[model samples]
Target chain A: MTPKKVTTTSGSVTGAASSFSWSKADTIRTSVAGVIVLGLLFWAYLLSSNTETGGRASFSLLIGLALGIVFERGRFCFFCIFRDSIESRKNNGFLSVITALAVGAIGYAIVFGMYLPDTSGEYLPPGAHIGPTSWVLAIAALAFGFGMALSGACISGHLYRIGQGSLRAIPALIGALIGFGLGFITWNTLYLRAIQEAPTLWLPHYIGYAGSLAVTLAALGVIAYYLLKSNTESAPEKVSGLAVLRSKFSPATTGALVGVIGTIAYMRIEPLGVTRQLSAISRKEFEKQSLLPETINGLDTLAGCVGIVTETISNNGWLVIGFVLASFAGALSANRFKFEIPTIRNSSTALFGGVLMGWGSMTALGCTVGVLLSSTQAFAISGWVFFLFAFLGVYLGIKAKVHTL
Target chain B: MSTKKISRVVALVASVALLSSITTAPSQAIPKNDTQTLVSADWLAKNINDPKIVVLEVSAEEGLYERGHINGAIKVSWTKELVDPVNRNILSQASFQKLARKAGIDNDSTVVFYGDNNNWFAAWGAWVFNIYGLNDVRLLNGGRTKWEKDGRPLTTAVSAPALGDVVAKKADASLRAFLPEVLKVAKKQQNTALVDIRSADEFSGKIFAAPGFQELAIRAGHIPGAINIPWKTAINADGTFKSTAEVRKIYANLGIDGKKPIIVYCRIGERASHTWFLLSQVLGYDVKVYDGSWTEYGNSVGVPISNPAGTVWGIA
Candidate 1:
């Protein structure tokens, strides 16, 4: 029997039937998504014109658009990246992270150098949290890593995934909100005892920009070497421009581009954050206000995922709205948007994991993006501390999954 | 005139002259030996019962005092009591006098302030007390954090002491910085120094305004030439004011001698007031609180602004 021909994104002629099936349904979905995006843009324009912060909100909306597009196209997510890297032995996912970090570090150094020259001893980045390094942060990171495994997506990942109609993420998001409240309830004791006096070590504070960059690059190089060593798959063939947009990006390409974009977002708007938005939703509903201490153990000193609660959507909130909208649009265009009610067990796992994520993020003062990426680029000890622990949690979670399966 | 009267008058005149000479020391703005500016946790615990010192806990958030506060310290919400609800500005003299009476402070009562966040709002309390012309207003050394950290006791008991006889004075212009005064300092850039006592982000214009609060300003930048010295720099890791020497050095290293006129501003002057307390009360610097701060300055049109991040007008 003759094999069916596939019009491949990588421009390769394949023998097996293609997994994706595009149809008139996808065309209708894409059109609706496009209209909604236009409506959102118009609404953003009107908002910016009326309110003083509307301009910022509008910018966040655009940022959301870019974030959604890249995330959907690249399939950028912690779980997928880590899973492919570890289990599938896919160098692409791991290479993407290394590239993104390397690029992000350079971008951060450039912006950091310009904004703060010899001022590190005096000035902290406005919204960036380079929280103190302590045992608490380490513990929190481990929980965060574990939570991501259970929940199936990091906070931001779930947000963008929602655009693609990922139903399991809904419970996870809800669980995260509960987790934030729990974190707030338990904050004072933990903060007063450990975080208040925790030693905050900044790489920039100790070593110059060049030194930090060198160390960051070296770490990435070592990881990349391992990620690529055992994999014998050759580089995928490149497609033309339009096909490229539809195709899933290689990890390195996605990582580098996202890194640059994330850096710009921090410099221009605010750091990429989602936990704060979740926390905000919790605060908006929890009218038993005063759940948070006014000072919050100097939590007010840093901004990310933590903020004053009001009805108005924060800048991060706007970014979140944009992310979901654009991702949905992107997914539909790529014929990838699908809605599914997850199984009871998987749904329960996502919800449980999400709660842990919320709790862990609050305890550590940020989620994956806020701590591991934004703060890491700032050379915060909290960033690295969270990263290592989260990685461990992810590893252990994956191991537990193998046992369960 | 009697010879004895002449001799007594002459003695008083001589003492005044000696006091003036001592105050003339350029290095020391106020007497170095004067320990009345700050009361330690132990000192406060000991003297809290004296009935003359009204310990007040000022917080930016509500219900903090109910959580756990310094014994005998009444909760003073910076938003509710200290500020005028209608204008969303500082309280008027009449309102301040009423607040003073509510706190059970008499004309001669010494006010010692304490609160959480290392007494961030407590310093604002001290500043408010000073504005009301309260004599001997002091901040609790190390605030409630140190007191709590050291296992000091906290009481949930509410105090409704006898009404205070204190008279509220008009807000002193010298202790406050108005737009005109700030503008003059920004333009002249001389004997006066403007201290942007906010986080580096606020100073750098990386963020237009503080998070949690509405963006009060359209522009994200500091007053032109204002130095970015965060208010926390005045604090110890334990949430207490650094030693006078350390604080003095902090300002001195920044070329701000307490002798020179200094203006400090933050988002809404709450945090700036903290710096004002440290500089004026603790280090005895001639510092003024620019209560309008970035909210006012950032919104003002045609005013020169310095944004280190070069972030402005929705552009990077």
Candidate 2:
């Protein structure tokens, strides 16, 4: 019998150990790396802690890893999901995302209410959690949502995808920083009139975490079941569950790990943030290095989010950077390494997209993660407003055909 | 295959370990100036109680300081800080020092500053401090607005004059460039290219913040022989500058090679700052941001500018 041949872009895959035929052993090796990295993170966050605050970091990482794995498996990127739903009229990815959000919200509410009682009125850990609502936040959300469509990824998604070599991400990130700066520039006027004037919207305290969680889970269940039933063909490609666990770690998988990272991110740092942290690094470098004037640095300077202070070397900043590098390693191990740069046609789109995001993030107060995800969990009005407006922006961008896609 | 995999793993482990060790010692390294532009909140929170840590809330609005400010911070009016409240341009060093002393800033005090509406004024002030050689200065990230929002302590108390010694340190007597720098660069056209970082209006002399040309008979455009490069083009929406590679591409797109000596300028030199830092510091290029900028040249007694759009001005 003639030897059958399968061709790939870089090389061909034949019957046995073809150049591109990823093996189970290879998958195991990558997964082992992931586990070891997660283990290191656990040691850093939980095992190292001695305070009453406990090892919240480990918990955050665990949760982020689990979520990351799930999202990766589901291909649950906000950009792909939202874009597919609006432009292509495909609903599977969109449905998955909505299900993920609902599931996340339900899980969080139950955990918060059942385990950690909020009797002591301390500020909540700033994590991949939620907070109150404001006009600024609403505007930022709308812009961020629009930005997600334009840039082809949301904030955290952009972070992971960068390792996969998406050129559009660079501009999107730049735009976020500009939006932050603009936010700083206009903060005073906004605060005097809108932000301070707007009432804070609390989720758990008002609705009761348990009831809210139950409602959320139910909502997700309904949506998932409906979407799944209506669109049978949209179900994700399944290998035996064990096979999935054994697939080579690609950017999609890295994204899921990021989810776990997000969980851990919340556990340690102020909140679950990828955009702000990365942008802040750029801002710090600019001001410190004097690449931009110190005056212009106001928007993202260290004082903006965490406070008007810093140590010799920022610990959280370095740790997150380390995570990004680790993610890069994961990407490299999978033989998928490329830098994503924009073409001329897409460059203009990027510039405009950046401009919108900059202005929008400023007005919104934060992006998808900060406003939408965090606020939704926190049960803030602006979070909901952001979600609605952002969805509208994404839809409009898709319909108008004003995007690179 | 196994050998390659082992090598890759070893390389990865070595690189990670190396980076982790290097990152342990974070540098306090910053730009060369009279003072540094930004500071962290952690720094502010720790030194909030220090008397010498004078925080100034400089904003456009007059009574913004009385509403809320850092515990001992005083409100310094931006209009009054350097402007004549008439010229809207660079203030005399003497006048600037007077305002500085009034704001409780001394020659020796480690000033940590911020202001309303994005802390631009504070940054501007920091820039000024650096020019004057006041070594200890930093900007608070997120500024006063964030501090107040986080429910960090804010006070409404305001203080008056405590005249302190403001020692004059003019390191480079020729720091404030006249028409020569532009003229020489334009005339020789050697390794130099003028980068107009000012707004289009200022470049065209449409809205005059400072007198650009008074002595030379130049038109209303950029330098007689230079490029019209806006500073904002270099920044992303997040108020962050583009990466080194991105910036390199931008310069290349403009046909201004990075290897060339680039001089950046704007209406009053404020906007040019972004480009100045980006090129010289970030990209490690041979460049200078003309802080005196267009305001000095456009309305100068008799300098020149290019009139028609897309026309380069050439001095006779």
Candidate 3:
């Protein structure tokens, strides 16, 4: 990035680059965010003192904190990444996804090997929730992809965007919850039919862990090779007013880090899932009203898109809080946090997009975190299925956006 | 992936397979039958030759047992054997007696049940036997999964054990719950807990049925104030029932203390049987399997329904 020339009253010349420039405003913002973060950690620690489950919950929140920081600074929003590639033909953003998938796949394979020393059996890796492969899954993923295009962000984006004081995020979040409700209502019918008939296929089940690993890596290689080879342009230098904690990072750096962090989260507690907290909240409310059925179809002890609705503070619940707070902290550090309320048009679209994402994710048994990222890494066939349909949905959504006023 | 890329990756994996003999470690020790009501793969493996020991595979899939199952195991289809051919009710006592004799089971038989879908239908078979007062009934812990995982020998040969006398008695009220009794439990709210052993969506009446199944009910919702704890929670990762203490604690946390009489149900009662076994036989609770379940309740006209999703027919 080009540095700007700055001359203080003292007749000395100095070049100031991005993110390092300090100002009273930056310091104030950082201080406020830091205090809030420390407060949250203290609360989590306090919670942990009561039980072992509390301790795990706190650790999960810390993991989410790291995720929030990386996501905010790296601009790792899936919507923007795909949109930039499909609309502008700029491919840099795509590199991050590729790198993340590469790292995640390797890490997951290692973990799977350790867990299932005898990989030949029909055991589904615990906690992966390798959901049934069916038409329902494809349609759901397509819906989620379309929602991402419409809302300008997926579930993760909405949370982090709110950290930056984007008021449109509020509607998006609300819409997602509503969409989740809709998904829950229709889940039984789907579960009994298509989902029941659909096979829960895992790559390791047939090919062995090594074969699945090789296949996944080879696929990623082909994608990365073409992406890197064809894209000749580097990013234009970023120029911002009154920079605080902002710093430019390569997609490889952010992606690899994301993969490593996500794997670690999965290894210790559960896979990277964002909707558990939201759905849990909705489930609890329904439970109170006695509106829930005696049983839901398909969902049992599995962890994924439709997570357990619990009265107690779950690990994912705490993670949700930590993600939002840490995202704010990250934004403040980078001086990227700004309160930008959307116009009626943008907000309406975002809300609808949120609804679509929620419904699609519910049907698919996960969002980006649960399906495309985590399942893909786990070598589940649903990963490939979701990948294909979601990309198609995103591609068409982008085209539709271009055609609209 | 595109067709070309898929083929390429498949070829690469296939080539890799040729180079190395990839060993897959199947997850070990199918679920253990820890409680009195269950038997493990190891236990069943050791006892299959006993004259009194009979292993029956009752699965929703018509030909699952025929494909490859435990050696000498008999197949029992839910629709064909357990339920009435014409009505939704369970088979009559005479029908039960006939089916039991055909499978070569008698009053003294130590019949063990197992099946695919994590023993979803096998549990139902166990419940049916309980109603007919089968003295010694057990579910194979981890069911077919444990049997297969441990590398137990599976044969497709049909069994022809000698028929023994087994008379079907009156329906056992202690094990089965009727709609009126369930309604009474709801109205009274005494030391009786109605446990909905289904997934969360079914509890919420968000949808009429699961993804693959056609709608089974006219309405969607739970009985008034039923606690929604899916049946599979009682099961371990290997498809075995969890330890008694652990399982007891899970229900206890859900306010279903063993002291309280518990009524368990699922969409059509098969899944509920799994939970019923866990509560009544494993955790030692006074539990009743609601055989009518959601299908009966949701379809009933003007019955008290608590559909939180406010599900309307054909609309979520």
DockQ of every predicted complex: 0.02, 0.01, 0.03
Please list the C-alpha lDDT of all candidates, in the order they appear. Answer: 0.75, 0.54, 0.78
Query: In candidate 3, what are the lDDT values of residues A57-142, reduced to their tens digit?
Result: 87888888888888887788888888787776666767778778889888988776644545675656657758789999999999
- Candidate 3 is graded, for docking, as incorrect
Stretches off by above 4 angstroms in model 1 are A1-29, A232-234, A287-295, A402-405, B1-316
Stretches off by above 4 angstroms in model 3 are A1-20, A232-244, A286-294, A301-303, A402-405, B1-316
Chain A vs native chain A, TM-score per candidate:
0.89, 0.70, 0.90
Per residue, candidate 2 scores C-alpha lDDT tens digits across A247-318 of 343322333333343333343344444444444544455456555433433232211122222332343344
* Model 3 interface DockQ: 0.03
Candidate 1 similarity to native, TM-score: 0.56
Q: Cα-based RMSD of the predictions, in order?
A: 22.5, 20.4, 14.9
Interface Cα RMSD in Å, per prediction: 18.0, 17.2, 15.1
Model 2 chain B: lowest-lDDT 10 consecutive positions: B21-30
For B154-220, candidate 3 gives per-residue lDDT tens digits of 8756666566587778888788998988888777745579999888998898878876666889898
After superposition of all CA atoms, the RMSD between model 3 and the true structure is 14.9
